[model samples]
Target: MGSYQDIEGQLRGKRKFFKQYSKIEVDDLPDDWIDQYYENGFFTRQTGSMITKKNAGEVSILTLAFLLLSHYPNEILNITIATSDFGIIALKNKVLREANSPPLQLNVTYKPPISYLSTDVSIFNAVKTGLIQPHDISSMRPNPKSSIFVEHFADGSSGLHETVIDTPSFVQICENPQKYTIVF
Candidate 1:
């Protein structure tokens, strides 16, 4: 019972995110959302202009997707994705693995894509793949203005929301947690 308008709104959210972060022109956005980029490797005029091939090589759209969705917890709860890329798949895998081991009780759901996802590795992996260009990832770290607390899992694992900080890393953070905030 969902209307195309609802879907468009979500896509619009993505467009707004691109505009806000990348500083691309809103009037120059492409009409089609997912299909346009998925089919034609070329991004829109403004998008392409802002994100040079070199900068594009450094950004990952999947990372932007995760960050954008994190900001819209409500919309993510209401929607469901048919399929997702390896970045998302990887998050689910890591969360599930953590849940099985003792002392690493990650109270998160993996089946529903929106409920569980967080990690820098997934972001990096998405960059390796052609799913997203480098310009899509945000340069700004989460909770940059404040001190962020991090918890690391077994064997140097990571997730979308969990910022893993070890003893040595924690010491480095303690020096200036706010300035050196890893994630939030």
Candidate 2:
């Protein structure tokens, strides 16, 4: 039986370790860290999707997951893509199947949209009138630096391939559907 002080000290050490670990940059990771992440699995989040076609926004988001994992190889990762479109999920499943990767846990949840006060009425009107495309709205578009795809894949010089779906390591993880514990 450890003393209360002993337990507290252990927890404090763990907190400090995690704090430092979270601050690690991609360049700081070990040379083999990406391989380790592929072997151990990692987390990814796609908050929303605007398109679900094969070569559309959903694919970009999925690709972003790979780019993010590559960028943050120091962290443990899980994949959570939240969207109203079933097609997005289906595409994920298809990719998983094609890749033959390890079983990945997934949960599907639905939450009703929350109403919020809008001060962007003029912007909305402009879009409705076709005076400005939705993409033309600064707020509607994500900041370039903030996007994993834009940061790592858009330049075609990142050395990291954008077509992560074809990667054998990713494909291997998709192979084991029986290991998946999906919740709806």
Candidate 1 residue 136 Cα shift, in angstroms, is: 44
Q: Which residue pairs in model 1 clash with each other?
A: 56-134, 58-134, 59-133, 59-134, 59-135, 118-159, 118-160, 118-161, 119-159, 119-160
- Tell me the whole-model lDDT of each prediction, alpha carbons only: 0.40, 0.40
- State which candidate has the highest TM-score: 2
Give lDDT tens digits, candidate 2, residues 9-111.
7567645644553456646867975455333232222347632223355655665554455455446246566543334545565544433333222212122
Give Cα distance to truth, residue 173, candidate 2, Å.
33
Identify the runs in model 1 with alpha carbons over 4 angstroms from their true place: 1-23, 32-35, 42-87, 90-113, 116-184
> lDDT tens string, model 1, 57-158?
212343344444445645665333222122444544544554434433333334434432233333334545545444544442232222233435556754
Q: After superposition, how far is residue 79 of candidate 2 from its true place, in Å?
A: 3.8
Output the TM-score of candidate 2: 0.24
What are the models' TM-scores?
0.19, 0.24
